[model samples]
Target chain A: MDVLLTSTAEAFRLLFSGNPEIWEIVGISFRVSSMAILAAVPPALVIAFTLAYGSFPGRRFLISLFNTFLSVPAVVIGLTLFIILSRQGPMGDFKLLFTQTAMGLGQFFLCLPILVCMAHVSLQAADRAAWETARTLGANRLRAFFTVLYEIRFGLTAALLAGYGRIISEVGASMMLGGNIAHYTRNIPTAIALETSKGAFAEGIALGIVLLFLAFVLNSLLQYVQGKGSINP
Target chain B: MIENFRIGFREISKSFGSNQVLEQTAISIASHDCIVITGNNGAGKTTLLRIIAGLEKPGHCEISLDDASPEPWRRLRKRLLKSVMYLHQQPYMFAGSLLRNIEYAARLNPALADRESSVQKAVSWAGLEGLESQSAASLSGGQKQRVALTRARLCHPQVLLLDEPTANLDSESRERTLQMLREFRDSGTAIVIVTHDPGVFSDLATSKLHLQDHRIQADDIGAADVVELDSVRQSKKR
Candidate 1:
């Protein structure tokens, strides 16, 4: 307990002391995760909307498939991409192995199912009247779609926050794909792993503190958004 | 102002799996006409209204406009959408101020050359002048109905389809809705109301129809008739 307390205190000092190395890792984590999420949102929303509102064959199958993907282990995703991006594999021609792009690619696939399933739930919970109302008021199909999106904005925001929280803290995919290359692809989770393995618990604890803070912030935001949308809140 | 029009929605067939709601239903609507449709629960009165408003797709549908050639319902969806508006039994308000809700319809109408002034006029027309800044969700059922009417006023649809506009309102709200609807009829817009209480609209309804056995029956607005609508030959003799 004494060692743990000392390490936590030292971690805070390192975090607040303008440590270039730690913040660089933080920056890389945010940049890669932000890009991954930004690329995933639009397609996820479309798929989610289709799954919720569209009537066609295989819709239930797709919904089940995405829900299944939500439980996939992060390290499994890392290993699959590692094999695919290896020189002996098909996509090796791109030479994307051990690069930030590879790490981003891994994170992208990781968060896409999360965004789809959650956004699908959000769309399903929304009233069908908003769409009909907009269309009957002379809005084209596209405009009506936007109107419905606005109506469910709170739920969508919560989905986004949940998705961002998932991708930003995952260490397995970043470790295998990025190889923890310092100052290039090394992110918070990867750096924390390396630091702890090397017995540098202070830095590791500092990064852990950041993750905890982020989780708290995200959960708080999610609570507020859900509260605003609830009828009894 | 909306141009006068006569629309015939012919051969509408809708079913939910094994349960058929409407089969070979037909109805004709013309400008300045107030049509009140009554039927038992589950008789598909709302379904027929939605079909006329182009909000639902019937199994096989055709339409004739102003005595023109009959066209496939799918082909004239945009035209129907432009000229028809359907108000729900309980008005669904968007998440915004009342002004925003009114402005939403105003924006969709490209004919409103000056959107701001048109919205202001509509707000005042609905007697919602002092409540423009209030949240739409907080309004009573009557105010919501007025807001829906305001939205219809801005759109100026030739056909306004209302589903139980007075079902959940108090007496005052019901009277106010009727007054507004009377004004809508006087402005040359065709009003089609689906209600359980046909007697409520007797003073203003130009015609009344009954939906039974998956069909809308009767011929004239001023006549008291309820016959099966096997194949309504809704030919406009104009």
Candidate 2:
């Protein structure tokens, strides 16, 4: 208990003193997560919309498949991508393993199912009238698609936040794929892992605090979007 | 003079599982025709209009516009979509300013030399002028209906399918909407309205179609009702 209290106090000082090392890890975490989420949203939206509105033979199966992917273990994703990008593996010539790009790629996959699942739910819950209304208003398919997207913007926003929240706190994929290389690919979650393992509780606690703050902000944004949806309706 | 064209639907049938909504229904509507489609709930009056508008496909249905080849309808839905407009019972308000909604429809009509002016004219015609700056989603039910009508008018569709258009409007809004419909008819657009409110449109109808038990209960009114209805309209105008 004494050690925990001392670590907590030291953690605050490290955070407030603007420690350069801590700031770099935080920055890399944001950069990778942001890029991965940006990469994930467009494809996720297209797939979700297709699953929601399309009547093709495999649509139900495809939706179920994505939902199944939503619960897939992040460590399993990391293992798969690590193998693919490793020195002895296929495409090894690119030497992407143990790099930030590989970490982002892993995070991209990690975030995709969350985005696709939530976006699909949003699209499914959207009013059919919006699509038909845009169609009969002489909007071409593309325009009608955008109009439908606008109708469910709240759900999309929540999906984005969910994806960001997942990627930001995820330690397994980032640690395995990124190798947590110092001054390069180390991120908040991995730093917490390393610090705790080394018995440097202050650093670990500090990183955990940052992660918790991030999660709080994302959840708050999601709540705001949900409130907006209800009030507008 | 407005060119006369016919909207034809042949043997259109649609079903969800074993529950058939529309079955092998045939309708041929001519220009300037004002059709009042009446039925109890779930009678598929709206479905018939949707099939004609090409927004929906019957399990097996076909449409031919006037003497035009079926190829045109098959090949150019995006380009020719302007020829048909459908108004929902509760009009959908897109997430934008009302003026943007009107402008979006107006952009589709290539014949409109000036989109802004035409949108303004449509807003005035539909009595939706001052509401232009407001978010359409915030409008009352009557205002939304008017905005929908304004969009349909701006598109200048030869055929307008209205699904229970006056279902929730006050008398004044209904009268205003009816007057707008009269003007559209005068300008040679065919109007097909699906409604349960016969009293609201009994005097304005050129033809009445009654749907019952998933079939055409009655089509093309008897001559006597048409004559009486016309005289009633004439008397009201005077």
Candidate 3:
């Protein structure tokens, strides 16, 4: 308990001191995760809307496929992406292995199923009248789609936050794909792992605190949005 | 001013699973026409209106416009949607302010020379001026209906399909809604209303139809006949 308390106190000191190295890792984590989620949202929303509103053969099969992927192990994702991005693989010609782009790609795939599943649930729960009203009001199909999307903006925002949370803190995919290089590919989770393994408890605890702080902020934002969405006044 | 418009749908049928809601339904609508359709619950009155609005796809359907060749409903659905506005039984108010909902429709209408002025005019026309800044979804059912009418006014659709536009409204609100529908009809908009209480719309309906057993039966009553019937019903109530 004493050691833990001391480490936590030292962690705060390091955070407040604005240590360059620790902040760099934080920046990299945010940059990569933000890019990944940004790249994933549009396609995820389209797929989710399709699954919710579209009538087509194999729709149930596709939904089930995505639901199944929700529980896939992050390490497995890393391994599969690793194999595909390695030399002699089909995509290996891109020379993307051990790069931030590769890490972002892994994170994109990691969060896509979550985004799709959550957004699908939201779209299903939304009133179909929104789409019909927009169309009947002279909106084209694309405009109607966006109008419905705006109607369910709260749900889409929550899905995005959840996806961002999942990818930002995930260790296996980031560790494997990024190679955890200092200054370039190092991120919070990878830095924490390396620091703790090297007995640098203060650094690890500091980064852990950052992650916890982020989780708290994100969860608070989610709750606020949900509350706003549910209450009419 | 609205131009001459005619829409006719024939052989329209819709089924969910094994239950058929509408079968071989045919209806014709023309500019300045007010058609009040009455029916029992589950009688497919709403389905017929939705098919006319192009919001629902009938299993088999054909459509004809004014002086144009008859075409399959699927081919002309986009055009049908452009000219038709369908209001739900409980009108859905979008998530923003009432003015925003009106502005949304006004923005889509290219004929509205100035969107802001048009929205303002619609707000005043609907008596929704004081409520423009209020959240649409927070309004009462009657207020939401008014907001929907305001939007429809901005869009200026040639055909207005209403599903129970006065289902849950106070008498005063119902009268206001009828007044608005009267204005739309006077402007040559084809108004199709599905209602259980057709008496409330007697003054506005040019013709009455009944939906029974998955088919529409046209009644020969003219507007004057409906108005007389409504007075009789009112006198009986007194």
Candidate 2 structure quality by residue, lDDT tens digits, A74-140: 8999999988998898968999989999999999999999999999999888888889878887788
Measured with C-alpha atoms, the lDDT of residue B149 in candidate 1 is 95
Question: Which of 1 and 3 is ahead in DockQ?
Answer: 1
Candidate 2 scores a C-alpha RMSD against the true structure in Å of 3.9
Task: List, residue by residue over A95-205, the lDDT tens digit for candidate 1.
Answer: 999999999999999999999998899789888999899999999988998899899899889889988999999999989999999999999999989999999999999
Which stretches of candidate 2 lie above 4 Å from their native place? A87-90, B1-3, B69-80, B107-111, B212-238
> In model 2, what lDDT does residue B9 have?
63
Prediction 2 global C-alpha lDDT: 0.83
The residue pairs found clashing in candidate 1 are: B207-B221
* Candidate 1: regions farther than 4 A off: A230-233, B219-238
Give all candidates' CA lDDT scores: 0.89, 0.83, 0.89
**Model 1: C-alpha RMSD to truth?**
3.1
TM-score value, chain A, candidate 3? 0.98
Greater lDDT among 2 and 3 belongs to 3
Judged by DockQ, which candidate is best? Answer: 1
lDDT of 1 by residue, B1-238 (tens): 4577788888889998999999987787888778889889999999988888888988888899987998989999888888899999988999989999999999998988999998998888888999999989999989999999999999999999999998988898888889999999888898999998887887778767888999887735433323222222132211
Chain B: TM-scores of all predictions: 0.91, 0.86, 0.91
DockQ of each: 0.91, 0.61, 0.77
